[model samples]
Target: MSKAFSAIDEDREVDRDAFTPGVEPQPTWCPGCGDFGVLKALKGAMAELGKDPEEILLATGIGCSGKLNSYFDSYGFHTIHGRSLPVARAAKLANHDLEVVAAGGDGDGYGIGGNHFMHTARENHDITYIVFNNEVFGLTKGQTSPTSPKGHKSKTQPHGSAKSPIRPLSLSMTSGASYVARTAAVNPNQAKDILVEAIQHDGFAHVDFLTQCPTWNKDAKQYVPYVDVQESDEYDFDVTDRREAQELMTETEEALYDGTVLTGRYYQDEQRPSYQAEKQSRGDMPEEPVAKRYFDDDYEWERSFDVIDRHK
Candidate 1:
């Protein structure tokens, strides 16, 4: 069998509208929901890159953010809460040619699936991970989430949440994500640009997207008047420098709670090799992807019965 199944049609021009499902089901997200911004930026990025919907695989975890796959016209898996990363990692390893992107809310990504997020970054998996940081758990009726600022009152914390919020960008860098960035739903242009860079990165990329929950978290900032670190003269740091990135990320995290919304690429390590490439270099993984073998009708497949007989 030919490898035509994985080939990209470079001759064709891809449109942003192509990613929108033909039978557009009316979106159920509430009016002024920041989730809509994520969808728009994602589609714009894919279209700008000239990527066909067939070439991409989007995996999402449970929460309001999980509905992203439903709106995006691409191969998708809506996995259990906090499990999108692992599923996305498996799919990427199976078919290295597929453009893998994982998304989830703060509670899903930072609370439940945090371990997977850290390890995936540490291993430098070639995947883009977008976390919708809306502070509270929107789908579950405004409960305190892992990213919720300290003292922020929610249904789960009626008086106030004493616990501090996770510094996502700094944590991602320390855990070993090659590309670390922060973008807000309020700034679609910057979000699209960052998404483009994240998708193009060869190693693990983590984007802490600040999405406001207008309906659930009334106290949450809409993330307006955001200053892009790259554009602002007030902020200056090298994205390739670990120490610089760390300092800036810490500042950004602190500033968010203090009413300053700073958004931009924080770190990128171009020299680091992705997990798949490292495995291949060590002769551990096959040159031909596992996905391709499944499509080959003539390829031999070992049977469970044969293994049992051999063991016996």
Candidate 2:
């Protein structure tokens, strides 16, 4: 039996009057949280992409950044800690038409959800993963996170963080993500542009924003100052060339310590096939063998055959 269904193509049209004042609820971050800029960038990117807020799906994990979903007017999932990717992936698989975005703080993504991050990139799912790299876990009260620099003292790492900070851009490039980019929360224009590019990209697009958590990460200002914004010359790296992307990652690391901030799309591939391609590529849904064998009029025979097949 075939079932009739109707889908609302709400995303195709934009409502100029759709957004009301304070549509996006104010996030519950500290007074001067860098996540505010990240949120603004995302909203700006969505507007730039002409995506209807009703047609968007934002999934977030538990953290300061996770609270972001509550502020957006789109369909959102405030998932358990370190599980934003699965929620976002499931949403996309269920409805490939919607623009699915997963977001969380560095601790939520890189520390607990690091495995999921790897697999998600490898699968090359057509979704955008935004990481707010604040270096410290602000929600859990000023603990050192995975991206926290070595020798950075925090509540959890008072004597200084033991391990080195994880290079998210390099990790993303190595994970087979079709698109990878990095920007700072302070640079909203560049951040919005990168986010827009990531959202429009075919496969898994990872955008890591170095955000500042004033309440927790006091030293974050050294890299991302509130008043002083560092600008770097844009280097055009062949996104399709993996070697070139890797070299760019190395150069970016050097630039970071040398006090030059890197921004813009570091990697991308327009030719990569999206996740929806597999299901859509099938010639057509197959007919049941039982239907072709006249099983509709012979349920007893079909049931016997099913039992026999199962035993075999």
Candidate 3:
């Protein structure tokens, strides 16, 4: 662990209220907004894990979901549109002891930041990525987002969108995310449980969170009566089996558009080493946090100008 985070490792019983800022800013979200559920569940999950706010980092992208950093009392970075993952990845690589989480809306994550989403999962970065999948772009006046259902009408697509929605769970699994799951804001219990597991996971954990946009997506199903795959006997499949997970994910994705919301852990591969672990195993990364080395006064450090002059 890095010297920077050595103090954070001290064990202490954490309270959920500890995450709330001293000056609580009332959320600006519209009435019945699902973002409130996310905040509550996240706080609950962190409290359950007994993680200190100083030990966690929250990186968010542009959109209503980006406001997560404002509400979450943690080390936070509000990055540009669709860039939360890259920033979170850098932080994790610099200080491996920090628990990193990246969050954004569907438009920001699956649309503008789709490449980052794919590559980050492909590289198996050790971070929890939460995509608030509300179908429409809630912050931008309800435009048809990447996860918008086929033929879904919006301000941008008054005649209804012609494109099919992206299957985030299947895509994450295919791209090598070691842990993948879907949860809804309406199901606070499930959401909290999933978040706790995701945070504790040692590999890339992708959570496709179904957030209802009551103001914009009034037509959206409230994600009620969500069937938990792990709890339901009707849907039995090995979470460790890639083929089984893929098949279930396909069915779940298709069912979402049809009004059935299936939510739970679809895949988990605990044996796969995370990117940071792989680098350390290969002796490419130092055991200490990279951030610590930069402040070493006694160590010789090369300046950028000196390197440029040498090259010249």
Candidate 4:
């Protein structure tokens, strides 16, 4: 075949090794970064899903996790800080067939974009939201974030943090996300399982990954490492039971610094209708950009400039 034809075929079909090379430039992450685990799990999940690279839209916010977009050969958008959800929701609404994923670090998702996170879950859009929870802000050179543990010291908190850490899993559960999960970056297999399941869910899904940032969270060596599933019994994973999941999130009796990585689904409800699926069923899908399917003829001028000129 000609070189042009070969190139065309390559675009039409994914190369087996395309995603295998993984993130480019070998990831500038510091030694023992949790983002690495999440990346592997994401690639594995995408491979398992067997979807076209173009059909996958990985939207990310500014942070260490945002850099993930650069590595994947699939369609990716590196949006402003805390804005990934809005973009992902829009993408999914525009093209219901696309597999949209919103990913970002804790600060990006819970700090600046905290409000958006809540609304996104309540909306129940058909998109996957993954938060890389490292406790500390690794990108801003070791700063305290919303999820930073109380009494945790950082450049921004010289005398230990004073504010309470935001419990993302519990918050998402209460926010009405149809699916919720928490996984350790160390457990690539389990992470893949949880992510794929979340993506397959019809409504909004959330997967919070507790990863280590050795450079920023000085206690990385004491807390982060490979996942020990058999030993994770101490961490509650009764996802079907919201009260139990909330208890687990609040019960930090065995914190990561104590050497127990939390992993498992927190909640799931396949029955919940996705934002797009519900709209399509009710014949509420927007036919024009400005309004829904039942827009009045007066709005025709908005759809075409030529029509307005001819009418004038």
Alpha carbon lDDT at 95, candidate 3: 86
State which candidate, 1 or 4, has the greater TM-score.
1
Candidate 2 regions off by >4 Å?
Answer: 1-26, 222-236, 279-312
Q: Each model's TM-score, in the order given?
A: 0.95, 0.82, 0.94, 0.81
**What is the C-alpha lDDT profile of model 2 across 17-113, one tens digit per residue?**
3322355465578887888888788888877776776678899999888888777667789999899999998777666667889998899999899
Q: Positional deviation of 50 in candidate 2, in angstroms?
A: 1.6
Off by over 4 Å in 3: 1-4, 294-312
lDDT of 3 by residue, 54-81 (tens): 8899999999999998988888999999
Deviation in Å, model 4, residue 283 alpha carbon: 2.7
Cα lDDT, all candidates: 0.91, 0.76, 0.91, 0.76
Ten-residue segment with the worst summed lDDT in candidate 4? Answer: 1-10
Stretches > 4 Å off in candidate 4:
1-16, 20-23, 222-238, 252-259, 286-312
Model 3 residue 84 lDDT score: 99
1-312, model 4: which lDDT tens digit per residue? 222112221324333345653555667887778888888888878777665565678999998999887776577899999999999998778656567899998999999999999999998998999998888888889999887878888888999998877878778878888898778777778888999898889999998888878887866552435444324655536556767767765554245546555566667787778777677677667533221222344444435554345553
Tell me how many clashing residue pairs each candidate has: 0, 0, 0, 0
lDDT of 1 by residue, 39-150 (tens): 9999999998889888899999999999999999989999999999999999999888889999999999999999999999999999999999998899988999998889
Candidate closer to the true structure by TM-score (higher is better), 1 or 2: 1
Worst 10 residues of 1 by lDDT: 1-10
- Give the Å error, residue 25, model 1: 1.7
Residue 112 shift from truth in candidate 1, angstroms: 0.6
